[model samples]
Target: MSKIVIGKYEGTIYPEKGGYTGALALGFGPDGKRRRLKRKGRTRSQVLDRLKAAVVDLETGVKSPANYNVGEAVEDWLAKGLRGLDDDTVVNYRSLAGKHVIPLIGKVRLKDLRADDVGEWLDGLAGSLSSRSLRLVHAILKRAIRQAQARDMVIRNVAELVKTPKGTAGRPSRALTLDQARAVLEAAQSSRLHAYVVVSLLTGIRTEEARAMQWDHVVAQADGEAGWRPVTADGFEHEKFAIYVWRSVRAHGDTKTEKSRRTLELPGQAAEALRRHHARQAAQRLRAGEEWRDHGLVFCSTTGRPLDAANVRRAFRLITRKAGIGESWSPRELRHSFVSIMSDSGVPIEAIADLCGHSSPAVTGEVYRHQLRPVITRGAEVADAVFGPGKSA
Candidate 1:
């Protein structure tokens, strides 16, 4: 047994239960009551270390409990930090936290978590996860720790100090060639998804945007100065049509980005397909009678319910298979196909970017780099002309 004086407080260290215990009075609390902190460890030095940490925490206004662990902080962030986010996004973050973060370091005390610990955890995941997934997991951990730090739970965010390790490469996005696109279009001509496939491939709208499209957004030219009217309007007749891309299936029915909200003129093929599809839908609605629910979505199931992404993918695969393109193709590739076709047809980068609802041409170039063709080839021809077909000497 011994006495330790830390600043003005006289503390005592005593042997208890085969371990050393340290106790100190940390002055009066806000409620005018005396406050104290205690630390116990297997050795006197260990007890001293804990006592010192407690004193620093007290001085710094940190109110985190000694038993607080990583899992608790992650759960707190998951519960509060994810408010107002899309439901799918919330679910994804929760799934990642549950599967990767909580299971591995959940038991580690928040105070004891270190940059080395985070680095090691990410490295362990690098072998199994894709680089994109690893980055997302790392971001989740960093954000969780940041939330804890804001609440004075931890001194610093160790996750932020550690860099995300490179993981396995994800599958590279590919676009259908012109011939394959034609084949797919032909195969879809007789299917219920004909309009969906045509619109997605020709307009380059995101699958989420397509799924959320409402019939009210589909407008056609009218005779007045303010000429646009929804096709659903009575006596609607127009040679030209367009759609207002205003919303998506995301939580709260908002589009993905401000730039994602745009008006796109429908290609002739897409418009024709949609006209036929609308007629077919009206017939189906009559058949379903009271069973049909009017969500007002342009694309829906037999009962007018919104189509699930999984079901859309399954139906899309059947069309690709029928076109002899195999079943591995996804609906998103239709957008990529649009970019590739437009690029190959000599569309300007900026025009293509706007058409695809991208924020900028640079973003389009970066994302669809594989699909964009070099608009300039005269440089090589001029060089060849200047070189005069020179032979190597």
Candidate 2:
């Protein structure tokens, strides 16, 4: 049995109501504030361990007298502050909070939490999350704390002072070469995602945009007699055989940006695959009869429901494996492959930006231009002419 100290601050051991070992600690906080902390544990050592921490908290005045925890703050922001966000964004924020923030630091009282505590917590996650994901996690905590501060609930947002730790380097993003793109297309021709692969690879449409494509948005023919064609100042037709990228699978069916709503010219491969897919879907609908749910999504399951992203990823991996390509790829990578292929084929960045519905050409150059290998040796020759003979190249 442990001896109880005679001082005003000491730890004591006792039996709880269930006959389990319990610990209680009496301590003096800052400015002679008396504090009593209690805890129950499976063993005497465990109870004493908690009492030690309580003593430390009392000594340092680290235990804030605030009424709320981090979890309450995060949940409040998620429920009230995210009222107008996209469904996917809200889902992602909820997942980040639940998976990272809540379990680790949720119970810490608002005023008790310090920047050092948050820094240490984030530093502990360096091995599990990637740099991009770490940024997102930091953003989530910071936004939640700021929201709480705005309501006068908390005096300070400690999360703002904590820097995001550099997380593990993520997988290097890559795009398929021209030959690999063709191979992927050939393999996908026999798969159910043929239309999706064709549309994404050829048109550079985002996976979200393609996933939300509907039959009404697809325009197979261009109007000739009605003079509805777009013309420049020089009087030239811009494009034909188009699809209106008017919506995505997000909540309320909104695109990523205003420029993301432009029309796209359907290439030959995309049009052919879409035509065949239409026939196949019609047959599937006939077979399903009354069991089919018609949500009017172009790329859907046999039951006519929208395709789940995970299911599509799994299916795409199967296709890539069958094509003798490595299976470490996602559907969104196909758009990158499209951008790379276009850049390599000498398509101007401005034109590619227009085709891909980017807000500006600068973004296209910044993201894809340098990453792509040029098919022509002209630029290399010019560099050689300007910089003398290369010592190694």
- Which candidate number would show the highest TM-score if scored against the true structure? 1
What is the C-alpha lDDT profile of model 2 across 1-393, one tens digit per residue? 464442345556776765445444565678898766666677767776666655555555554333578888888888888877765678788898899998888888776789998998899888899988889888888888888777766667889897798999898767987667777877897899989997888778888898899887776443455333322111212234457888987778888888888887666546666767877888999999998999888899999988887789999999899878889999989888877777676666677777777899788777776555444322212222322233221
Which sections of candidate 1 miss by over 4 Å?
13-22, 39-49, 186-193, 223-226, 235-237, 249-259, 279-295, 300-311, 374-393
Model 1 compared with the native: what TM-score? 0.81
lDDT of 2 at 376: 38
lDDT of each: 0.85, 0.74
Task: List RMSD in Å for every model shown.
Answer: 8.4, 10.5
lDDT of 2: 0.74
Per-prediction TM-score: 0.81, 0.71
